[model samples]
Target chain A: MGLLSKKDAKLITDPLADNNPVTIQVLGICSALAITAELEASIVMAIAVLFVLALGNVVISLMRNIIPSKIRIIVQLIVVATLVIIVDLVLKAFAYELSKTLSVFVGLIITNCIIMGRFEAFALANTPGKAFLDGIGNAAGYGLILVIVGFFRELLGSGTLLGMQVLGDPIEKTGVYAFGYENNGFMLLAPMALITLGIIIWVQRSRNEALIEDH
Target chain B: MEKRTDKNSYTIIFATVMVIIVGSMLAFLATYLKPQIDENKRLEKQQNILYALGINDNDEKSVVFISTKDVAEKFDKYIVKQIIIQGDKVTEDDNAYLLDLKKEHAQAKDKGHQRRLPLFIGEKDGEKFYIIPMLGKGLWDAVWGYVALDKNLVVEGIFFDHKGETPGLGANINQRFFMDDFKGEHILDGTTFKGITVAKGNADPKNERKEDFKVDAIAGATITGDGLTAMIKKDLRMYMPYLQTLNK
Candidate 1:
């Protein structure tokens, strides 16, 4: 806490609540829908996004002064791609087992709207340190929603959490299955992810009325 | 006055410079890491092959391969022979396992190029496992696996993996539940090599009826299941002529 002043600290804290990337800005919904079918996937995606977003923001911020505005978007895209590939290559070399898990997310990370969103919105105008914090905050906030959705989806859909049969084996008809509680096949689908995300947005807006717009 | 960065020539130069820097950096890193990455992949291939032979460190629920540090020794101990069948010119090759299937597939497509098929024959407790490697297309990207069979052509064990299948859905192909179900399933329907099918709604969730040549498909993974099914059929059928000799 002492390492950051209040202004810099807000760069980290604000996105977790007020400027929440997924819920408020509604960015990165693609990945939130795609990977949140399981808690493990959501967690993996969260970590992947966090790593990319933070490092990418710092890189973009450092280059902001010299970057030509005409092709800034392309530059951002290239940067993201380079960073993701470099990380993947390093992981494959040093941590072979972990690389297998992370490699699957490489394409997902490079294409994430959140990384681009943060680069254009915050990094282009901010210092490297502030952009890094903002990246961490936004990614965390996004991950928080993904984890929530993933929890409900995996719990209800598969009757499991992180592949653990917490509700007992569905096939064996033990534990919760004994209570005649059936798993909802719909929860595993993308529509359910959208609906779950909508519910979170609704709840978040209710908690903070400022998040809602009078249309 | 236009800023230095805002000029047309500046934008082009910036683009060119960025590309060169990023490109060289990436190319250099890839080159530097090639050895280690290739080593990891080699180790992984051994682990996957051994896994299909049922020589692993798996538990009640997980698909844990033998540790990398000890895998080379264990692979040598279990796998008695490595054979390559190139259009009936079958021969023993210690390094046959290293043959890149992707390259072989590409070459085989060329005129007069016979696909070199690598097979590992593993021996444990006086039992033999004829392990075959396969590659197929999943919904998102390439899906591949290794399947081991006994003399009767019944699947002994299997290991499935993918490049970019959907997590928790299609990617569950590598999970224990899906891979374990293939065990004891026959690849042949009475002298005819009929590869096993991942049938959905076949009323066989338990996979007890191995003779039916069907395994219950993973829920929400229709494409990956089909890919695995096709991979087994396509790749295994190629080796039938050579495999059929085992029974004789």
Candidate 2:
């Protein structure tokens, strides 16, 4: 898990590509859709989720034996939420404007299936270090899809990336580029996130024909 | 053999400890940051009001010139009075301009206690501006906005936002064309009360005397448009008697 061994390296790096969460496992798609409208906001949200999910997994794994079997889920939830409150407070302190922009998406990270999925699937049985790496890799997988979706959505939706003007205005305003800077503003909306994510799934599956052909 | 604790004892201890730790931590955090959060919300409200008034305070250099105190003073001096009306009676709330509606909503239900409505009156140059709060139903939830008027009671500007409305359609109230269409439309004429109307196409081309204040509903968002129209008409109609005081 420290990158000292082959099996540990495989567990850590594989989720980045072949065993990707969004592309392969298809976990955590809800936040991926809700926050991927802006590249800046999506990146911020991704980092926050990565921190919470990984830390929650590590802490829960560390406490695995001591936690009563009957109330394990509740314990995990409490730890995750405490971490979330800290993150929420930090954001309100340092990034008040962005915090407002992100709204409830930050708090919703607790409900994100990726964190709980890892708690149930990886954290309970796995070593603390391995559980942490697994959490990081899975979070990276979620972040990858979000960044891709956000890249396209922000570019097309606003004719800008990270709020900077990339595509020039239509000829009427004296700039170039024919795709038109006018907001197909719908792309900025949440439904567009679903459509783009669906497309990503389609393309990924088509390339890996064995997934479809296996049945 | 290790002494095994009773299951009931562990359960009670765990719940109690977790509750105390989590609850105290939250209490501590809230106590520390509540003031900063309150200040941010206050500044944000001031900015919203400034935007509605069409005051350009964007330049970084101007940030030094425009502080919350400046905005508050300007708002206080020019936006002179706040009136609360229920049925035919009108009473004044001195701090109505500063009153937070989010706080106002939490008061004990007084079926008999009157709802204190705040009207912001700001003057620029010599013209009086009436800033009225507009609230109504949107497609999915409650929509609220501010409609500002000049001394003549013609529309000045509007700033609308909603809880959950379709982004491209109903949410277009945030756009200028919709809000600007409200500018220059008079809500009253002397003693006769002519409530503002929201029309389709173009409002039956106004006369020279009444050229500026006309609102046309956004074409496709008929339900939202109708709702907004009804909202403005209803809220302004309530403030009609209070507004008549400005003419004197």
Candidate 3:
């Protein structure tokens, strides 16, 4: 039998929707709630995750045969750590200010269950190319939710998109459209991100019939 | 051909080597960056001092002008030294204010009050200026700022910095709009110190000081604003003796 087919592709692709990493699978919720407050930071985080997930999956799948059964998990961990270090160095050098804003969140990528879970469950069992694609697909699914959540939070909360003022009405001089709220409901807080993510999950899962029954 | 290999020893040896290698690398990096980091900090402080004094000259001129030798050589011509006092008595010495309060605060672990009472005296175009340092507690962390005054001890410019205050609210203290409001505000009357004060919104910045300097506080960050006022008054009071000396 061929390793991957149309049916297999459908299975892999469907998880992006029916079994979303953040909304449905309920995995990798920590970063989803933290970095989603700002669109720029959230987008950077999404790209970082995409790189780690896809690369980790491919490497683990490739070494699956040669890796000893007893030390496979350890080997996987080393590869992920190496990749994370490289990412950290690059971030520090190129994106100094953004890196400061992200702080420890970038380093926490190593412990993200989504990366580890995908490596063990899907990557180890599948061919390298398929594993890589699955990783990208799953990461894309996660990124979609994060971007959506981040977009609304930053826009409504800060009254700006990407730190640029989209709202022209001034409250200082004329007092028209004066909400008197300076920072769009404290964009610094984490609870709002959780609430937004919960709403997204509810909306997404409510549309899927298989998940509707709550088995 | 089979051989007996001590796997335990091999693992121990590898672990030891890895630890040593990583530790030495981190130590080397720290050592390399130490001088540059210190230089960055020194240059930043020098700039802040010059900025606080409202002197915008070249870096070399700034260092030469601020050096102890130059200060002494041009003593009566430009720079004037002051002693700090509290309640009509010298609390410490004039040199106490010269020490960096940030470094002292870190070493003290928030245990002691390392108040800055030093006032910088500088001259430009035959006009004298007084540069004062103010330190206070903000909503989340420590806040420190500088106020520059003319020979008359009238406020000319101000700069405020906070550690971790909310950006838009508390951090607005760094904006020129806020600082520009301080210009021409007086802190002394003849030889008596009136001290800096916080004013209400729409209040006149030039209101005669009976007890305060009439500096306006940020609306949302009232606590921080009040904290700033208290810091300014307290720090200014410490320099009364020196101010009196300058007046004479």
lDDT of each: 0.91, 0.69, 0.64
Would you list the clashing residue pairs of candidate 2?
Answer: B78-B122, B78-B123, B79-B121, B79-B122, B184-B212, B184-B213, B185-B213
**DockQ, all candidates in order:** 0.79, 0.26, 0.09
lDDT (tens digit, per residue) of candidate 2 on B1-248: 43233266776687788879888998899779888887766665555565566553545311211355576666555556676555567677766556755444445265665555677766677766778877778776677777787777777766776655543346567655566556566777666666665566663422223443346665435677777877777777767776777579
lDDT of 1 by residue, A64-116 (tens): 99999999999999999999998899999998888888777889888889899
Residues A156-202, model 3: lDDT tens digits:
67555565556533334223236554545555456778888888878
TM-score of each: 0.97, 0.75, 0.57
Ranking by TM-score: 1, 2, 3
* Tens digit per residue, CA lDDT, model 2, A99-165: 6544556566888878888898889888789888788888887888888999998788866677565
Model 2 interface RMSD, in angstroms? Answer: 6.4
Q: Write the per-residue lDDT of candidate 3 for residues B117-174, one digit (tens) a residue.
A: 4555557677777777777888767878877777667777666766655444454565
Query: How does candidate 1 fare on TM-score?
Result: 0.97
Better of 1 and 2 by TM-score: 1
The best-first sequence of candidates by lDDT reads 1, 2, 3
Candidate 1, residue B19: CA error in Å? 2.0
Point out the higher-scoring one by lDDT: 2 or 3: 2
